[model samples]
Target: MRVVTFCDIDESVIDSKHTIENFQSGCSGEAQIAILDINSIFDFEENKHEACADKFTTIAIVEDDSDYDAFKNFGIDAWIKADDFSDINELINLIEKRLFS
Candidate 1:
């Protein structure tokens, strides 16, 4: 399964570099992961093209409860708290379950 991480650049704990690197390192083999900044998506000029509509599984890293409604409304499969998970493996497991099950 392909995993994509959508994160807010303004968030203190999850910066652009960390978000990109974490997604890259987390999805190492056959499965692929891409990290995209939420600002890019919101900016039409920056994100000229839309993500593939058929690629359904997406995980958004949210900093607070307020962001949950918007992310969920966008059809994200899951919302993960960056500070909560002990490791990437736990996040991967959630992805696996959502995508495969």
Candidate 2:
């Protein structure tokens, strides 16, 4: 699986389609990015999550409600509230179990 991040993102998050496509592993792009092609003709949020379900996963961990609202608009698969966990280890354990189990 892959995780792609966009700094200073806009509400039109789907605009980063090319960046995601070129992120596939073993892709021969200029920067040797990963190209996990799900055979998508166009990059739309509707099938994007499903198309890359096996190849990519998006997640966010926010410390504030405002942050959560902002990140949620960015279309991530999962959101972990930092406040829900007491410490980094506990948070990490939950993440590991969620991802591996």
Which candidate's lDDT is highest? 1
Q: Where does candidate 1 have its weakest 10-residue lDDT segment?
A: 44-53
Write down the lDDT of every candidate, Cα atoms only: 0.43, 0.37
Q: How do the residues 1-101 of candidate 2 rate in per-residue lDDT, one tens digit apiece?
A: 22232221221332332343332222222221111111221232443443343444444545566765555554555554545423423433444467646
Clashing pairs in 2: 23-34, 24-34, 24-35, 24-36, 25-34, 25-35
In candidate 1, position 42 carries an lDDT of 49
| C-alpha lDDT (0 to 100) for residue 86 of candidate 1 | 38
Candidate 2 Cα deviation (angstroms), residue 22: 18
What number of backbone clashes does candidate 2 have, counting pairs of residues 3 or more apart or in separate chains? 6
Q: State, as a TM-score between 0 and 1, how close model 2 is to the true structure.
A: 0.32
TM-score of candidate 1 versus the correct structure, residues matched by position? 0.47
- Model 1 spans > 4 angstroms off: 1-56
lDDT of 2 at 47: 36
Q: Number of clashing residue pairs in every model?
A: 0, 6
